[model samples]
Target: MLDLTKLSQQMQGMSQHINREAEASRKRIEIALNLMEQAKLNSDNLMQKHEEFKQRIIFKPATPLEPLNHYPYIVEPPLAHTVFATDGSQIAPSAHEIAYCYLINVGRVILHYGQSRHPILDSVPEIYYRPEDLYLSRQWGIKTEEWMGYRRSVSEAIILAESGQQLLEISPNQQLNIPTLALVDGSLVYWFLEQLPSEARDLILQPILQSWEQLRLANIPLMGYVSASRSSESLSFLRLQACTFEEPNCLKYCPGTGGMSATGTEKKAPCQVCDPLRDTVLWESQLKPGQRSPFWRSNSSILDLYDHHQIYFCYVNVGMEIARLEVPAWVVENSEQLELALGMVIAQVQKGYGYPVVLAEAHNQAVVKGGDRSRFFAMLEQQMIKAGLRNVGISYKEARKRGSIA
Candidate 1:
């Protein structure tokens, strides 16, 4: 059991440290805000600086598409539109379980506003027990939880695309002109693929690329909504503005060294003024509710593999918190579709009280509670017994945890 009494006693000291950190963070935010103003004043030259130093910068900074200080108010949503969202959950394969299998459940939701059609809400669950599904390579090792998470993200996007296509096929002829927005739960940029080998990354990315292509072909705007996002792409741009050097070279004039060495050799040090700030810190006060920041193209190397589907992102104030919305280049290029997507997202947040209703519903449909997990194992055990498996049982550790003697 947790020692609440000890934890309570320690809270006093912890609170003091937290306060000190908070004060330091406040100072950093003030400096960052000043740098942001500088960035806005030098907005025209900012992109040139980015282009000059992008190859050498150690961190990922977003490429700005509009002026840095631009914050546009929300546009009115279309009178009649549909929002489709998909989310996924997975049960990781465990060695201590009675059965060596995993499951992926994708929940899909379709909400139509100003239309008589009923909302669509459902989940599709699939089980995987075959060796091919469980292992990427027997010599390398069984697929890890991280791999499973990437797979789940891919599955969510694919389902969202399929749902959008189905909506287009079934909609009435008049409703065809009405806008549709497809949303997924998180970042569209597959940053996780950066660590995997080319072959392994291709295996996960090709399917997601195909899904994005399908959405693009159907002229459906697909987006990923991240709540309370900690992304720093915007902050990174401001950091570049904070650099005192005319040409910022992270390696030649490293942040770790504070500057070049006495012999003109390169060393590195963190930026004392900007290192502690996040993009949200600078925008939380600047952007009013229903306002969104300017768009920026993600500089992730993974997007190099995206082919025609490069990703762009912007920050939005959703009343409760700042959210990051990522979309493909096609969505950003089409002014009408982009506005429709932003308006619908803000409207959804209002309807759901600070969160997107369709996404929330999809999550509700995807979540796997503890009781459901227990029931799933029970059913599996019964089926195995019926199949004449004599030695089917959970490992000792699992049994001990399930029924602790203490």
Candidate 2:
């Protein structure tokens, strides 16, 4: 009787284990089936697009079209040597509305432009947008950070950064000088410019390249301000490699990206292999010129005498690379500098525009779209107004730095 009791307990345990195993196996199969279905759907979509393209070619196949691009002509050296930064931004599903703007500075006056224009704002559905709910988001800006969908993050980040640049261009009066340095909020490399449609891409490159031609002829100085948005974010990525992941390829620390090339007025497509970081500072490089070592990982890009200060965008042109670097940590402390710059810009804008604060709203209004943008807009507005600014409105959408996009 005792042996029979022990055998009965063993049998019950075995049966429970088998049942659990079967359930686990069933789940795996379900997952596999779902993935297969998704793959099939993607394949079908590609086929349909291919067929459509084929039809266009069959009917419209004609001559090879050569692109004719013209650069603007400027006769004289800009009144005051200046800097102009042009930028563009895009949302996930709403590719139709890529934000394009420019910032101009003749080494004195800050030219800011901000307008919400929808270019190539497509109502296309992304694979991730739930089919049932996609109709609600068709025309609305679609964005969400996904690990597997990292490019979405990149695309949106670039879009927000671009809007900030455009905010600089939308001067109420719209008159700017040449020989300006454009302090773009991102990298100096236009490799990613090609990611945009041809016309959309030109909206960004045309002005700067035109200025480049004019400046080159006039022998003037006009570079861009390209810097990382937040220093902490940059630090997080660095620490991930330095303390967390210990990623390889870390070489000597450099102040700027070495060996920059002069991109012509004709914009080209973005190179896939190009590094995603800002072009202002060579994050991973040795200080020596012509060394050509691998990328570096450190906060030594442009540390001020005290330390790396980010609030004030630092302009460092080492060899061919001209970059604008911001130390977010530093920006938090010395906000007065940012306020001073905005104050100067607002004053300049008001000199020509009707009102100061009202003019600033065109760009500032759009900053708050979905939720509480009051704290943010108020802070920026207060900063500008406190600086005795001229009152040129700003699009809050364009002003929110990286990671601030909704």
Candidate 3:
């Protein structure tokens, strides 16, 4: 339950905080504006900033491609094209069940756009009840869900990769000239891997990497599109370049400069000078319809493990939302593939009213409704009963809710 009054008060405080720091944030933006144009040509400046932080920086926001610029390059997708999108919905482990169980539903959508629109949609639900799947620790001491949700995420990526392969076989008679784009619904680099144990990460990330390899080997273009993204990796780079601090990683030692308070009386916290704007918000004014920002490589520490699969991103305004799109290094290096992917994504967004039609369809197919969850558990209960198992009833609290209504 939420305390409405307290939450309301916090919102007021947040507004005041923004007001207090507005001027300083504006100044920081001005400083960043000066560097934005020269960010690429003056690589020495960024390099010096990077050298200052050295090993202290957790994630480095270096651009392996071109630097920040406002040049809007709109790539019109091929007149006849096919787009494939995959998304996943999961049922987390619940305590009201007889057995420790979970379920993952992966939804896939393949759409042919141009003269005639033909859409193929499918969903596959995977159920897990094995001891290994339910527990993480050696002695079954800790539940897998307790640690993190990486298992489901990894599974989703693997399934998404498989779906991409299936898209290739969709129509053997189709012309080879028609561009095909494979898309997933998140960042290409799995940051959650860093949270898991080293051994667990190795075991899980392997399949995801293999999926990327599969797509690459088959000459399929893949992308990860995040709509209205809150990621600030690009802003972090701006901070590094805009900071007045001569030393590397001043955020570590300088507690005096974080986020601003509602009142200007207190010292600001670290990284507050950047004004806390996400990369998307920062670029909303810069990009026009169908134009995408320059590629920014993700500096996440987890990205180092990707080897050849490191991720790069660009912001695209598809006449609706400023979306962040991520792709592997291979995709970025290939000029033709990048242009086709960007064009197809923009086209999809326009067709779906600010979102990709295929992705939205995949999401619809993947979603698990509340009634569906209830029925699933009910089915499990019946199976338990039929197997002559006792003590398989739900918790008393759940039972009371089932019997009571507001």
Candidate 4:
């Protein structure tokens, strides 16, 4: 049991620290806003600087597709439109359990607004227990959690693509020619693949890219919605403008405090001007409810693998919080698709009271409660026992955790 007295004492110190940080952040935001205003006037110079330092900057900076201060009012959604969303939950492989296996459950939701069609809601659950599925290699040097996460992401995207294809097929017969939007819960960029081996990366990424292509061919706009996002790519651009150095070379000027190392190593140092500002804070201050900031292209290294399906994003104020909406390059290049995607997103958020209704429903379908996990293991053990399998049991530590006795 936790000691309440001790926790109370620690909480007081934590509160004081947070207060100090908050005060510092308030001052930094003022400076950042001033820099934003300057950036609007000197947008051309910033663009030039971005081109010059594109390769040297360690942090991901957004490439602006519109004016620095452009905030467009949310376009009203079509009276009759369809929205499809998918979310996934996973049960990581545990050594203490009866079996060294994992589970992925993807929940899908489809809602038809301004029409009488019934909503579609369902979940797909798959289990992987094979050695090849559980491990990256025979030696088990690499953990399966990251690989499993990648697989789950692939499943989510594939499901969305399949959903889009199905919608397209039936739309012609059902006369459902209204606009449609597909949404996923988080980022589309597979950042984890950056460290994986090429073979492993391709094996995992190909399916996702194919699914994206399918959606493109189907002419369905897909989006990744991140709520209360803490990404700082936009702020990184501001940091470039706030650089005091004449050349703005991150490596040479902003090396470690002791300057260049003996080995001439390059290291990233935080800019004193905009060290802690986030994209959410910047947009939250700039955009009104139901408004969206100008679009920007992501510079994530993983995006290099995205090819023509490059990811672009914008910040939308959904009343409750600022959300980062990531869409494919194809969707952004087409004005009709872009407007339909954005309008549907804002409408969905409004209907769900600050969250997308389809996403929330999908999350509800995908979530696995603690009791459900316990029951799953119990059923697995029972089935194994029935099959006359020997040595099928949980670890002693797990047993103790399940039932503790003084």
User: What clash count goes with each model?
Assistant: 5, 60, 7, 0
lDDT of 2 by residue, 1-406 (tens): 3799778877977978989867765564443334323433443443334334433221111110111111111122223322222222222333211211111111111332332332211111123334433332223232232121333223323333333344345532332332222233343334444344555444345554443343333322222234232222221222111211122211222112233447533321121112223322322232332112111122222222212211222322223443233323322243343333333322323343522222133223222233333343455457667788764454455456433745
Model 2 misplaced stretches (Cα beyond 4 Å): 1-180, 195-208, 215-220, 229-406
Give the whole-model CA lDDT for all candidates, comma-separated. 0.85, 0.31, 0.75, 0.85
Best by lDDT: 4
lDDT, model 4? 0.85
Q: For residues 6-81, could you state the per-residue lDDT of candidate 4 as single tens digits?
A: 8887787887899999999999899889989988898788888878877776567888999987898978988989
Clashes of 3: 7
Write the residue-wise lDDT of candidate 3 on 220-260 in tens digits.
78899898788877777765655556675654765545345
How close is every model to the real structure, measured as TM-score? 0.93, 0.22, 0.85, 0.92
Off by over 4 Å in 3: 1-28, 37-41, 48-53, 56-59, 115-117, 137-143, 146-148, 173-175, 243-272
| Colliding pairs, model 4 | none
- Tens-place lDDT per residue, model 1, 1-406, is 8999988987878878999989998888888888888888987787888887788778778888888778999897977899999999889899999988888899999999988889999998888788777776343442566667877877887898888789878864745788889988888887778877787787789999899889898888998998877788888777777777788777787646544678995554444366656777778968998899999999988899998789999999888999999999999999989999999999999999989999999999998889888888899999999999988998999999989999
User: Looking at candidate 3, what is the lDDT of residue 138?
Assistant: 44
In angstroms, what RMSD does candidate 3 have relative to the true structure? Answer: 3.8
Alpha-carbon shift of residue 253 in model 4 (angstroms): 2.0
Worst 10 residues of 3 by lDDT: 139-148
